[model samples]
Structures are given as C-alpha cells and as structure tokens.
Target chain A: MSTSQDFPTRKSSWKRFDVTVLYVFDLLGTFAFAVSGAIAAVRKKMDLYGILVLATVTAVGGGTIRDVLVGRVPPFIFRDITYFFVSITAGLLVFFFHKYVERRFKLLLIMDAIGLGTFTVIGISVGLKFDIGYFGAVFLGVMTATAGGMMRDVLQGEVPLVLQREIYASACIAGGLIFVCLDILNIVPDINVFISAAAVIAIRMISITKNWNLPKPKI
Target chain B: MSTSQDFPTRKSSWKRFDVTVLYVFDLLGTFAFAVSGAIAAVRKKMDLYGILVLATVTAVGGGTIRDVLVGRVPPFIFRDITYFFVSITAGLLVFFFHKYVERRFKLLLIMDAIGLGTFTVIGISVGLKFDIGYFGAVFLGVMTATAGGMMRDVLQGEVPLVLQREIYASACIAGGLIFVCLDILNIVPDINVFISAAAVIAIRMISITKNWNLPKPKI
Candidate 1:
C-alpha cells in the first residue's frame, strides 16, 4: 500500500544502482527462460517458428499480463524491443547448441532461480504503482515469477509444474510477502528490492537443491 | 480503421437493437464458455473450486485478454459483474447436471458457435474503438473468440484444439475479415455486426456438420 510519497525525497546513487541491477536481472531472467522454452520446443520437435514463439512467450508472457492488468498499453516487451531480441537470441542459441545447454542443466536452474526472484520483485513494484492493494501486488508478483513457465508447460501439452508439484510459486509468494512488509516499514526502496529478490532466489535455490516438493493429493 | 465519424449521425432504433442484441449475445457466450470449461474440469476430476476456477477463466479469459490488449482497465467482466455471475451460474449448473448436459452435446456445440461469433464481432468493435490497425483488430477478434478455449485446453494438459486440428479460429478470422471489409464499405454499423456474426456462426455450423478440420502436420 506504500506510495511514491512514502519514500525519501532525496535521490541517491543507490537508487541508480538498484535500477541498473534490476534491469540486468530482468534481461538475464528473460534469456534463461527463453532458453528453457526453446529447449522444450526442441524436444517437441517444433519448427523454427514454433521454437521462437515458445521462447518469446516463456520469456515475456507473465510480464505482458502484468502490464496489461496495470493498464499499461503495448506491454513492456512491445515498448522495449530489447526483450524481444534477447528472447530471439536465446531461442536461436538453444536451437543450435541445445546439447551443450542441456549438459549444463544445473547452470540453467540457477539462472532460472535468479530470473524468478527478479521477476517477482519487478511485478510487485509495478503492481504497487497502481491502486491494486497489497494482496493484488503479491498475487501479481507470484504470477510474474511463475506464469511464463506455466504457459510454457501448457503450450507443451502438460500441466503446469508449479500447479502439479513444485516449491516454485511458494518462493515467489514468500518473497512478495517480505517485499510488502519491508515497504510497509518504509525501508529504502533500493534495499527493499534487493533483499526481497535475494530472499526469493535463496528459497528457490534451496528448494531445487533439496528436491523439495509440495504434497500431491491422493486421487 | 473506420472511426465514429464514419458512421451515420442518426441514432436510429436499429442502433438500440444492435446494442441490446450484442449485450445479450455476449452474456450468452460467456455462460456457454463457462459451462464448457466446467465440463472439462469435471472430466479431469477436479474439485468444486477447480471447476469454478476453470469455468471463470474459460468464460472471461479471452475477453480479459482482449480488453487488456486494447488498453481497457479492469476488463469488461470487472466493470460489469454480470459476466461473473453468469459464469458462476453456468459452472454450478454444469457441476450439478453434467450427465444431462453431456447428453445434449449438440446443443452445447451450437451455443459455443453462437458465442464464438458474438465474441468475434465484440472484440473487433472494441479494437476499432482504439487506434490499433485493422490487422490488429482482426487479430484481437480471433484471440477474443478462441483464447479462452485454448487456455482451458492448456490447463487440462492438452495442446489447444484450435492449434491442433479444429477449424475454429479460422472461422473467427474469416468473420473478422468480413467485418473489416463491411466496415470499410461504410455499411450501417448494426447491419455490419449482424452480418459478420452470422457469417461466423454459419461457418462454424457448416464446419461442424461437414466434419471440417485444419490440416495437421506429420511428425
């Protein structure tokens, strides 16, 4: 529920650093997500166009939905063509070098965790800009972190992994809750973003390493 | 691309009729789509909450996406809670009377066709209200008509029927094209809506009866 007026009036170098770091992480996440999507498409034996489409959707789908919900027209990717190009580059790289990429699956998972964390914070920040309440902001944050992969799974003809069994969305939700609490405490915005994102990354990485899972219902 | 200026200045009774008919059909489509979604969820052995969620998503997902694409805030369903009620009603009915409903599958198909046509024209009309080009308008039209079903299928862990083997989206595309052409001819808005929607319904009905399908790629 914090607004722009809640923050300190003075601008600081830390703010600039926060912006740069967020932007870098966003792009990194986009690339990692796109590569994962492209690899899935390749496994499905999709054509080049299908691979690109899946890559782009996986990389930017969640943010696009987030933007639209906030009444931002043209979405972020449409405004910044860089995301599109980055997804395309990732798709192409995976298409040509998928064997090497698959061999480095652990690296991909690490990058994905980073992406998830960054996207969660980004979505929360964007949602806070609007009049949507804290719950909506947190929901958008989890959605931004997981919706792209959910979509990628759906497109590949499977139930979304987050829905089936994963600690993935839980990490985003936990991070989002932390972000809201920090903001309510009037923590510095730059510090808040970094801390919240790091929390998400840490949780996701630990879950992955431990092979933690959400309990499944008996049929 | 036709704007408000291109339409006749006279506010005829036909205009009122058009508005009423369009609104009614829109609700009809929402209800039918929701029922379809609920049935799918039931088949998947999902619980009541899952059925409701699927029903609401299938009913409103397409229009929500369309509204977002056109920069409309809160989406049409949020602004008019009638759609939400309609979807919920449909879901509950399906949950209770699925056996009877399944027996009338032909009737469901007919209702679905009506929904597809109504949604297509509505989406195009909304798009034209904005500055997006004709192509974008038509694209939105198809997305509005089909995206819900696509999402429903994806959530059920299946490739979308439209992408796989149906002649569904093609019918919407054809209807959208017809709407644009008729609009360009400066036809009366009321007549244009009717003709375009009828065209979609007719194409869909014929395709169903004739067992028409889009070509599938050989793996």
Candidate 2:
C-alpha cells in the first residue's frame, strides 16, 4: 500500500544514491526470496497461510536472527511494515502466477544473490555499530545473508544450499572481510557498504557461472 | 562447572519448591535436548564442531527466539554461559557414549516434555513482564517450547516435528491459555507457572501415549 510519493527519487547526493541503490536491492531480494519461499510451499502442497508464513519468514528470517544476536530486538522488520507487505505481496503474486513464476527460477536465483549481498552489508554495518569485533561482524554478515534461506530450506525438508554445495556463505564472508579492510583504510561508511555489496554480488555471480562449491568433508 | 551446593535445598516454601523443581526440569530438558541434537548430528555424520553447534542450538534456540521477539536480547544464554556449557557437555558426552545413549530415547522424550513445559512457563513469564498481553504471552510460550526442536529438525534437514505431528505446539497453547485463566482467577504467579507447566507435560505425555496428532491437510 505504498504511495508513489514514498519513492525518494529526488535525493541525488552520492551518499543518498548509495542508500537508494541498497534499498532497491533489498526490496528486490526480499521479493525474490518471498517468491522462492512461496514456490517451495506450493511444491509442499501447503495451504495459503503456510505459503504466507514461509514467504514472510524467508524474507525476514536472516535479518531477524542477525538483529536478535546483536541485541537489536523488536527487529527492524517489525518497525518497518514494508518488509511484511512485500513478502505477503510476493507470496500472493506467486500463488496466483505459479506457471509464469516457475519458469523464472534462474532469474530468481540472480535476485537472491543480490539480496544476499545487500543483507550482508546491512548486517555487518549493524554489527560494527554494536562494536562486536571484526570476526563477529563478519559472522553476523554471513548470518544475515544465509540464515533465512537456510530456515526456508529446513522448513521445506531440504538441506540448505549454504550447508550443502554452494559458495553462498563464503561470498558473504569474503564481502564482509572486504568491508572490514575498507573500514580500516578510512573509507567512507556508505562507500564501503557499496563496494562490499558489489563484491558479494560479483563473487556470487562468478560462483554460479563457474559452478564453484565448497569441498564436502570426507566421512 | 556447577557445584552440587549450588542446588538450593533449604528453602521450602511452595514457591521455592516450584523453583527448584522447575530448575531441575530445565536442566534435564537442556541436557536431553542437547543429547538428541548430538545424536541427530551423529546420524548426519556431522563433524565435532557441527555436533557442538547443533547441540547448543537445540538447547537454547527456542528460548533465544522468544527472548528476541519479546525484546529481551543479549539472551540469558549469552549472559549465563551455563547453557552453552551444558549443551557442549551433553554433546561431548553423547559423542563418547552414544551407544549407551542410543538406547535411552524413551527417557529423552520424557525429559523433553518437561523441558518444554519449563521453557513455556519461562517464556510466558517474560512476555507478561513486557506487557505483551495474553495472546503474545501464549505465542511466546509456544515459541519457547518448540522453536529449539524446530531449529534442530531444520538443521538436520527435516521438516519441523512441531509443524507436522503430535500435540506439541497445541499442548503449549493449551497450557498458555490455562496460565492466563489462572491469572484471571487470581492464582499466585508461582502456582500459575507450576500448574501451567504440569498441564503442558501431561498433555504431551498423553498425546504420545495415545498417538494423538493434529490432522494433516488432504491436499
């Protein structure tokens, strides 16, 4: 139920541009994540309510966990109703348009990577604000990027991509390390976040293109 | 690292008795849940670190989630560290003595029920303190009782048992409603907690004995 006026298109400062770009990525990622979760519920033959619940959790679960761990309770998603609306809307769209959406799985994957990158940056920034140390910041970033999808997959009775055969969490970790290094070099916070997000996105895209994966442990 | 003298046995008021009993149940549940988690990790052939992580999460995930939702972050587990130690100890014990532990699944189930009841009471009490209202209290109670097991199941690559079978969350809800009813009838807080916890335990035990379960969707 957002009005067109809610779009802040006129703010064109370098800092403001970075904020808008990240916000757009966040929204896109949330929407894609919700769609994937909804699709998952559909496959599981869950009811409408289940679809909504899955979608909402997949969209916000990672950030919620990150916030909770860092003691930022009554999480940001609770304060900002838009995330809820976005998730619900995405679920509904998927429910009504499954055939069309199902074919776009590849596109959804790309969007999920973008969301991962953006969430990683956001989580690390929050961790830095709490002064939880460099390692803690990176851990939080990885949590924010992957925990939601992990929960979604678990709820759907599947191994999480990050835990199985994917470079998802590693991308977040790499991005987080870059963010820390940039901060140490006195980079502006906004620009640091932008570069980190870009790094995550690039790494994720390359991994997908190359079919990169973490080595499975020998049992 | 607990001393036997840390167990208070001198105070014998009804409230004191309730506290001690619940404390015992809490520890029992934590230990049992950790063992169950360790067992699951073992079944999955998780590494030692994975076993410890799974055990710790299964013991504390539910309560941590409840605390976070109720704005009680920097969760008690983080502050106490005992929960961490308890989970780790349980995991190590299971790793070393799994064959002996494997045959004790029945005992573990009984302890899990007790832990569920205790955690449910603790969550509702915290919710009440936050003025989250009757419904919020009940919701938190259920979350605290079930979220750990759900996380454990998810991490083990399965759909959460609470969402699928038995009277697990339903029992929590029933007990929470009883807690509120008792509050309305002016029952003492400690007594309310004790009675509510007993109700949850009873319901869970009966459900298992009778093979009771919520209806699955026909679709």
Candidate 3:
C-alpha cells in the first residue's frame, strides 16, 4: 500500500486517436454492463424495482466506485441523465421479456465480452483523466470493469467474485495494457477501445472455458 | 425533483443536544447491522467472502452513504479500524456457529430492530452534521437506515427496496422528527441518542408485527 507519494510510472502515450477510441468503447462497455445487470435481476425473480436497481448498478457501479477512489466528486452517474435512462430502458425490456430473451439471445455473450473489454479500457481512460501513471491505469481498469459486479453482489447479498475468483478481474488488467500500447502507437482512440475490449473479453472467455485460474493465497 | 436549492431547506434542522449519546447508539446500531449482514449470508448459503462482504456492508453501508451525501470523504470504513474488525469477527462467529445459533438466536429479531432504530438516529445525525436542515435530516436518516440493505440486495442481484417500500424508510423519517424534538429541548446528547434509537426500534417492531405500513404510491 504505497501512498500517493510513490505514484506508479506509466509509459508516455496518449495521442488524440486514443481518446476517441475510449469514448466509443465506453458506450459499448456501459451497454454490456446494463445487459448483464438485467440478466442478473431476471434470474433472481426480482420485481421491477429490483430490476432497475440491478441495471443501474451494473451500468454505473464500476465508475461510481472508481470516481470515489480518484477523488472525483459524485462520479459519472450524476453527470448525465442519459446513463440512467439507458439503464432503465434496458431493465424494463429485461423485466418484460426475460424468459424469451434468455433462451434466444446470443448477444448476451457478446455483450459480456464487450463489457469486459470496454470497461477495462474505460477504467484506464479514467486513470489517464486523473493523470495517473500506467500502473494506476491498470489498477483502475480492473476496478472499473469489476466494481459494478462487486457492488451488484453486495446489493444482492452475495460475495463479489472479484475477491474470490482470480481471473475475474485479470482480464480487465490485460486489456488496459493493450490500451496503453495502442495509444503509444498513435492508433485511433475508438480503435484502441475496441482492441482493448476485445482482448479482455477473449481472455476471460478462454480462461473460463479452459479452467484457467490464479493460485489462491495460502493462509 | 427538487434541485440544489431544496437541499438547503431539506437540511434546516435545529434540534440541539450534546451529540454524545449519538455515539453509543451508533455503536449498538453497528453491532446490530453486523448481525443482520451475517445472518443474511447464512440464509443465502454464501461462501466466506460473501459473509465478509455482507457483514461489512451491513455494518457500514448506511453510514458510508450518509457521509458520501454530506461530502465527507472516504466514509467510516476509511475513518477508523474498529468497524472492520467488528464486522469480520461477527461474520466469523455467524459462519462457525450458525446452526447452534440459529436454534437459540432470537438475536436476529432483536438485532434487526436495534439496527433499524440506530440507523434511523444515525441518519439524522449525519444530516445534522452536514447541517442539511429538517427535511434533509429526515430524508438522510431514512437513507442511512436503509441504504445498507439496498446495497446488500443489489449485490445479490436483487432489486433494492429503498426506491419503494415506503413504510420502512418513513419510520426512519418519523424517528428523525422525534430526535429533532428532543434536540430542541436540549436533552443530553447520550440520552437523545438512546431515546431516538428507542423510538425507531420500537416503531419498527410494532409496525412490522402489526403490519403497519405507509400507503403505496400510485404508480
């Protein structure tokens, strides 16, 4: 636990292209998070209010926690009404058509991937926004991608997988690094977001499918 | 719907007291909260990490949210170590002795009442700390008493009750008023905390047992 005095070093990067990519990825990641939230609520036999809370947390929980961590005031939820509106609409749709959607939707898997990837990139972007170095970006990226789930679990009275499952947040960390690399190469920001998101989603899917996991810390 | 201007009016409470009893009630309230969190985990078949998260959130979620609302940075989890230790110990005890405890423990019922009551008082205390005024104090009080449960639900992917379930929160509002009245009379702060806590606990128990509840809002 090094204090702020020993801020981690980051590679010199961040051309204009990187920023543009981040913006695109951010939206995709948010939408994916919303989908995941909706699915969780639908599975839980929750009423409308429950669905709404789940959707809101899935979409914004990550950033809300991140904002608090970075000393940003009130976080992004209060910044715009669009975010909330999007989550609510998503929740309503999930509530009304959950059974049919769950059976038919292949998009959920894609959304999960995109969400993992995009959120990782967004977290790194937040790190850059606050002038944090590379390591900070990686840390924030993981936090951003997983904090929503952590919060979602807390709200649902479950333990967050982030603390127990090794690979859960590792995907985001990997994607964040890719984002840093893309920026250094002066790639378009939107492209950077896509690439980073892809990396996380793929890695996560592969890890899960292959039963890859980190060793648990011994007591 | 009310904007920033409403915030000042909301917080305009002037009930004065020594502000010490608040501490005693707050401690008892925290303990009760811890019990609730741990019990929920037991009910849900959550793993150890789940138990830890639940215990922590139940103990501190209300206060943390209140602090955030008042623009107090880092909240109580960061402010002191006592809460962390207490929550963990409570969680471990619940996990290890849940079966024996479940048979013998009327503790949950009593603890829940105390938790609700203490939380109601604490909420107003936070409002007063911020000098948010009368309406604000009660509003905050309700939020404080219930936000942890809301968080608890969200984590389990359940819908939060705070946005609905008028009766539970309204009791807190009433409790805030009771505390404010005592404050205006310049009651001893410790006594004020106890009285206010008592009012909330008693109200919760009576209301729940007798099926007392606020009128449902027309959707």
Candidate 4:
C-alpha cells in the first residue's frame, strides 16, 4: 500500500515517500516500542510524565546501551534532538491511542519486525563505521535491535525474552550477516539498506509465523 | 540504632566496627533500592523474573552508568557477584513482603535517602580509584546514586523523581563534595566515609521532610 493509502486523508500524508518509508518504518517501530513501554507504564499506573519516561526508554534504551558499550560519548539521543522528538511524538500517540493500539497488537508486532530489521542493518552500519570486527558487528547488531526491549522488560520486571527465546537475537545475527554479505557484493549503499532490512523483516516474520526457532538447551 | 534495629539482618551482620556498618549500609542501600525497583516492577504487573530485573537495575544501574562515563571497564557490580546476590535476596523479600513494605512508604524513603548517600560516596570512591579528577569524581558520584532510579522510573513509565526534585540530586552532589573535602583534609579515609555518608543522609532526610525545592525556571 502507498504511504498515502496508509494515512487515508491526513495532511501529513505528504511526508510519505519510498525513502521516507524507511524512516516511517523506523517511526512505526518507535511507536510500537513506545506503546509496549506505555503498556508497561499503564500497568505501573504511572502518571503522564512517568509514561513518557517509559516511552522514551522503550524507544531509545537499546541504542543508548549499544552506544555506551561501543564507548561513544553521550549517545546520539543525548547528542541530537531528533531522537527525543521521535520518542516524545511516539509517546503522545501512545498516550492518546492506547486502547485502539492495544486491540491491534498483532499488527504492531509485524511492524515491529520491520523496524527490527532496519535497526539490525543500522547497527551493522554503525559497527562498520567504528571499524569493529565482523564478530563485533554481529554482536552490536543483536544488541542494538533487542537490548531496548530487554531493558524495557527488565525495568518492567520481566525476564528479557531475548535471553530465553532462541530465535529473537539469532535472527538479528542472521540479518547482520546478510548486511555483511551485501556489503561484500558491492551493492549500492541505499539498496543495501533496503535489502538487509527486508531480509531481517522477512526472516523474523517467517520464523514467527512458522514457529521456527533455534534449538533450545535441554537443561 | 543497632544495625539489626534499622536494617535487615544479613549473614554475619555484626563484626569489624568501622567497615562493617558501611558494608551493611551498602547492603541496606542495595536492599532499599532493590525494593523500590521491585515495587515499580510490581506496579508494572510483571512476572517473577521481571521483578528481579527491576530490582537489579534499581540496585546497580546508577553505579554502572557512572562507571561507563568515567571510562571504567567492566562495571563494578558485574565484576563482583556480591551485588547480584544481594539484589536477588532483596527482590525475594520485596516479592514476599510487598504488602507490609508498601505500608511503610515513608520509612522506605528514609532508607532510600541513606542509599542515595552511601552509593554516591561509593561511586565517587570508584571514580577516584581510577584516578579521575574532582569534577569527574563528583559527577560520577551523583550519576551512581541517581541513574538507576531514573532508569527504573523511565522503564516503569514515570517521570524520574530525581529530575523533578532538587534535593534528590542535590544530596548526592553535597555528599560528593563532602567526600572531596575529607580527601583534601588528609583525614583518615574511614572517618571520611562515615562523615560524608552521614552528611548526605542527613541532608536528604531533611530535604524530603521540608519539601525543599530548587527554584523553578523563570522562562
């Protein structure tokens, strides 16, 4: 569906584009992530500000953790205001549309898969930018895509799904390899982003649909 | 008051006059911090394992953040398993005694103040051990004391009380200064710890009691 079709009649529909769709995917990911955070907040019966805090962490905590681990100073969300804007916007939407959003949790999960793929690729890109080893890049991608959710779960008092679930982090690792392979093929950078992201999203969605999982330890 | 009177009885609660209380105090702070985290987790309606995550973050997050900022490798909590052991024990207590604990919200705040004081000093000490300067030391100190709570609040979807209240952070700063002053005075290190910890605990307790506040921004 076209971006315009997604919004139906909203004026901001003009912001829609194929390239921006990548960003929209990211934004949708941010929104769903923030909603998960918001749902945790609601469970906590937090005030509006508290909800926003949870929303912000759910939106950015993984990236922030990844940055700190890579020894980046002050992390991007702290350095650039754009991330803050995205988080706040997402948080407000969650605050207003929580009921409707919760009813569509399954659809949001699919959108989350897309966002996860995009982030996994971004993580690999960042690792390469930092001259990290391939192993390090894979680790960074896995951490970047999932740590925020882990952090959100931890803060909300849940065991991180990534810790126990065999497929969640493994898929990010798979996508990171796809990114590495594409990079080795000398693909155009923009197409690389699209291909890697689509790969991750596909892998994740298929795995979930088919109940495909990495072998679990019998213990 | 005897350690038994004000704090929970841990293994071998009494011995070694000077350092024992401080270690116990650290444990006390850890317990209170972990409890607060667990309460927030419960508020979020998380499962059993989730409570442990919240508890651990609440207990160690502030110090871990401070360590990263100061370029410390391997956060102190992870380097020593003592913290995890203590945190989990505290979490179990919270899980079991949540009802009774909730009734003593005000008392818990007092314990939290003591925690703020002790952990701030501990963070500063950790920074100085790395040969960090006074500015960096104090900064880490405050971060060590408050960041975990902030993370807890953010994850639970609440505006961090630390940011909202002046005394919350101010107490850590004041305690950091006290640690510095005693260090400069060439006072015995053990005496310094006692005095500095007392200074923070007293100040925080007073601030909360009086509802002390920083002036609001004129803008």
Docking class of 4: incorrect
Weakest ten-residue segment in model 4 chain A by summed lDDT: A1-10
- lDDT-superior candidate, 3 or 4: 4
lDDT of 3 at B159: 53
Q: Give the TM-score of candidate 2.
A: 0.60
Give the TM-score of each candidate. 0.61, 0.60, 0.57, 0.55
Candidate 1, A2-88: lDDT as tens digits: 112222233667775656767888888999999989999999999999899999999999988787777876678767788899999
Give a tens-digit lDDT track for model 4, residues A77-157.
544445556666766666676677678978878877876886776666667667788789778877778887886676656
How do the candidates rank by DockQ, highest first?
2, 1, 3, 4
lDDT of each residue in B91-129, candidate 2, tens digit only: 998889888988887888898888888888887877777
Model 1 alpha-carbon drift over 4 Å, by segment: A1-13, B1-56, B76-150, B158-219
> Candidate 2 lDDT, tens digit per residue, A52-76?
6578778888888887777665566
Q: What is the TM-score of chain B in candidate 1?
A: 0.93
Instruction: Return the TM-score for candidate 4, rounded to 2 decimals.
Output: 0.55
At residue A78, what lDDT does model 1 achieve?
67
Q: At residue B195, what lDDT does model 1 achieve?
A: 94
Q: Model 3 off-target regions past 4 Å?
A: A1-28, A46-49, A150-171, A186-191, A198-219, B1-14, B17-59, B65-71, B74-143, B147-219
Tens digit of lDDT per residue, candidate 3, span A105-216? 6576666666777777766767876888988988988887888887766665567767887576888877887888888898755566667778898898888778788788
* Order by TM-score, highest first: 1, 2, 3, 4
Whose lDDT is higher: candidate 1's or candidate 4's? Answer: 1
Error of 1 at A182 (Å): 2.6
> Which stretches of candidate 4 lie above 4 Å from their native place?
A1-24, A44-50, B1-145, B149-219
CA error at residue B219 for candidate 2, angstroms: 2.2
Q: Which stretches of candidate 2 lie over 4 Å from their true place?
A: A1-39, A45-56, A59-72, A76-150, A157-219, B1-13, B71-73
